[model samples]
Target: MTGSSRRDFLRDSAVIGAASLLAPATMVASTTSDGAPDVPGATAATTGLTPHPGPLHEVAQDEAYWKKVADQYRVTNAVTNLEAGYWGLMSQPVLAKYHEHIDRMNRENSYFARREFPALWRSARERVAQFVGAKPSEIALSRGATEALQALISQYNKVGAGDTVMYADLDYNAMQWAMNGLAKSVGAKVATLDIPEPATHANILEAYTRALDANPRTKLLLLTHCNNKTGLLLPVKDVATLARSRGVDVVVDAAHSFGQIPLSMDALGADFVGINLHKWIGAPVGAGAMYIREGRLDAIDLAHADESAPPTRIDSRLHTGTVNFATMMTIPDAIDFQQSIGIPQKGARLRFLRDRWVKAVRDVPGVDVLTPDDADLAGAITSFRLHGRGTSQANAAIARTLLEEFGLFTFQRNGIAKGDCVRVTPTLYNTPADADKLASAIKTIAARG
Candidate 1:
């Protein structure tokens, strides 16, 4: 499609809101009986677009470049979407790859699954390992972070009777549950604490120190690198080192941090970690991987003692029966798409989008921005609570009002120690104008109260 034609389509989409136009002009409609659309934007092989040659932060400020980046995704005009925490949308290139893999899997069936898929699966694991700076033997793919985390938590054999497994209030809900179950199964105790509000690096460290001192028997610490609750970025390395000093093993949850920020197993200094490729990596849903630092495999028991793989191999720790093969195969495409834009550039742009709205609403009357302004502590996902409204019902209603009244989509998050709040997460497809609209919407909502 011509550039002018594409512009016209997008312009008309604002009024029409047709489902068909949701796919950008760059997208190729499906022509096959199976109805798989062609890959959009630049194909994985040809996506050599450098985005911008300037410094990373300068590249983030280049709106024209970001607009081009935004065109790579298919976005709907139905509402301004600010909730990207659930799962990421695959770019056209990645989606096309997924469809291709799906079609191949269906056509070849057992021939591909038994003979060919094993090698491809190994390559996918290697790709994920390289992405996270780990060895192939240390990485094992799972359906999502939750699966990997559950395996890690449930299989943890360190804590015995009278010992303790600890998790914070800000950790993912499933991980917390797994910790509780692990403690119960091992005849251990569960230790819980709340992450401090207005969390700064020093204060957060202090909080963990206090928690560790209070629960000396805490043998396992479930530390979230980037919290799902309010997008609070934790200093994992520091916390992990402290835990180690106290003879505690740390199981880091990098589910939300994997592709959104710079992540490396070495940097995190955690022996066990779980990450999701589908969240910020732009891979299809059901793509995640777990990391067990070399020599720590014995800490986690083999999945049901099935003896499928060697006990030394990390895959032995997970026994996911049958996974979405197509989703796993498309991970390389998603990684390539993200790399084409560069991680530093992507992280900066997301924080820029976050700052655009937050700076506008931070001081607005009755509006409480939950995330700290420090770049080290915050990212694209930030939650806010209207003053005097802390209940789950109130926060959910605020989210509903945003969508119903302002056509802005967001999510209400509970389990925050202080109170429930509405989370706002802006993705790659969102523009500065969308952030402004969110700021305006929140201000209007606050005025109503």
Candidate 2:
């Protein structure tokens, strides 16, 4: 098909699908009291029954119910967004709250920054702590996960010549870059363990344990809860427990796992944990967080604190100077939205969407599924490589064709040396029909080649 013709086809198809998807929710008039939808059983009962009267099992599969949740997000009109792992598009409620925060901050000016900002930040921190099952004092707000990771890494006072830091090949590039720079400046060794495709919990834990055993000087171990590319879920709690027993502190990069799965930072037993709210929480871009154990707070250098500042104040070190309050304010809203729907239900829905898409293409002649099919080993994100196609060539061709020809937006996972794959991430807003479209597109592309 010609480019224009392809665009037209996608446009027409999306319009029909979008309308059908949104009609149920749009038809329900908003009640003025809380501005929440006036659905049946809108209020929770005394028995703590969920407002929606249905079996928990049935609620997750209800197409109209999920569409109502999806309608909250004002996504781009031109494409089916499957790239939420990189950055989540904000929902209408969050965006509206964020704008109100911006206007309030602007109106109050320096007064807000000096007087009101501290209180607001504390509230945000408390909400985040509750959301992730950590102590409020233990959490520190950061611009994003990268900054949080950097803040944790910058704490070591002595690393010259003999010390080493270990991380897996699946770690995020930004964290990898920071580790490399630290190695150069401190003369510390950087070691990486190669993780296999479709890795199991046992395999991943064994690789890290072996790496730590080999490198006696390994002072800190960094691991991601889920890889951005492969979407492979690591046994973080087990790894942390093992590493701690070996006298090594563990820092978890939870950018991909935080909102995508159920998490409790304290329960995981990691020395440090960092996550990006923009990806899974559906918060405004630029919102993220870091957690440090209370007693261990004094170990890290304060990146923005003055010499006179208290050594034990974790937030002081991480929350220095002026910040975007509007973005920060949206964190709670996102958290509430997620909580209202319930984490387990949301997770199941996401997994269902992922499995539906993966199953459709798994047997295709040239496709190699990189993510584990087991639900425990995966959630939301899934990757697959096309046989006989190199990373750059396949990723470029597929990504271009999907957007230009099919109106699907996805992340190209070609740069990683391991294998080439296209990553598809479906959020609460995504429907089974969306999965069908993706499967059809991938099948078409594979057949053409």
Candidate 3:
């Protein structure tokens, strides 16, 4: 499609609230007669795709084997990227499918959007819902995790005049902002506290217990399945059960965890949740989903209930007026790719890479790994600090030095409360060698200190 035609479709689609204009695009998840999984519009090469290739426990540790998988991404070698938590780059297979969608969208233009885009969007949403374990009716598409989370927090209507809302330091920063704003919107009190420094299951649970006990009127709790800053995975299901027993509702921010690890509404036991398809799911950026347990939609008010669609409609809850149609269309392709590789393999590889780096640097003099020792409490993301380098500036300096002098790229994060630290996140594209390089660079930096 030409630049002008793209603009026309965006304009026309937004006006119609129409997602696509194809010929009743009917993408289904039907298997072949031989029982092989068949995904529509995913004609990308299937050479590396495998649902099960022996035990993933062994495959996850096979660096050479994963290196071949890493070759599928067009990763830059100019700098060792340890910041994959921000957003994931699509694999070549998924990227190819994305380009095909882009080209198709351009070709069909308004003709496609007006005629068949709705069904195509449904197929995408349905597939995403299936991947995340929810009915299509319970899911709504959003720009990303932030938008879905903000909408969930802002629309939370269960709060009475003096009810309280609470969040912890581990929650995403923007999500904290939304929770804080609840005080004004619901005329509710806002409670905030920090998670334990040397995070332990007992201490983490104790922190929430103290906050909720102190605030008897706590009606809503914001929980992060996996924190962005430090990569701490909270006890979401346990916390949700505790809150529900106390007459408190929970809204889970699963932006980083949903795709990184296996997730399902039944597994999380949350009434409301917002997750990103772009983060660990490997879809192109600008894709996310929101969930409100089917029977409990009345707890949150809709954004454009009366103005656009009714509050009863889940999609109307978030106003995705115009979006990257190609990106949205590519979610099924990404899901297919992820399923083929297997979530267990994907997560195990991430944990393997994380352990590779942490195990190496944990003993370095003046080097402190901030993430917890419990394997279950963390994922691919981890953080560390120089013994005396507790200030944000010091951590930033270490990160900058690693990037400039050692040719390693890393980023700094605050809210550790114990100390500012540098975070390292490895993706599927990363290899064990990358982890060794990061570990070596950190040791060198620590020795120089």
Report, for every candidate in turn, its global Cα lDDT versus the true structure: 0.84, 0.73, 0.80
Model 3 residue runs over 4 Å out of place are: 1-45
271, model 2: CA deviation in Å? 0.8
Give per-candidate clash totals.
Answer: 0, 0, 6
Sequence-dependent TM-score of model 3: 0.89
Error of 2 at 304 (Å): 4.8
What are the per-residue Cα lDDT tens digits for candidate 3 across 2-120? Answer: 43442343222433443422233234333444333344343323534564476867988876667556655777779989999889988766776788889988999878765556566
Q: Which candidate model has the greater lDDT, 2 or 3?
A: 3
Q: Which of the two candidates, 1 or 2, achieves a greater lDDT against the reference?
A: 1
> Per-residue lDDT of 1-449 in model 2, one digit per residue for the tens?
23333223222132222111001122323433433333331211111212244664576678877866776655666799888788886655556566677788889876655445555566677788888888887888888898898878766444567789888777888788777777777889898888866588788778887898999888778888888878888878888888888788888899877778777886567878888888888888888888887788766677654332345667545643456777776677677656667777777788888988899998999877788887678999988777756567768778889889999988787545586678889897788999999999989888886
Judging by TM-score, tell me the better candidate of 1 and 3. 1
TM-scores, one per candidate: 0.91, 0.86, 0.89
> Which number leads on lDDT?
1
Model 2: CA > 4 A from native = 1-57, 158-160, 414-417
Candidate order by decreasing TM-score:
1, 3, 2
Best by TM-score: 1
User: What digit string (tens of lDDT, one per residue) describes model 1 on residues 155-233?
Assistant: 9988999998899999999899999999999899998889888789999999999999999999999999988889999
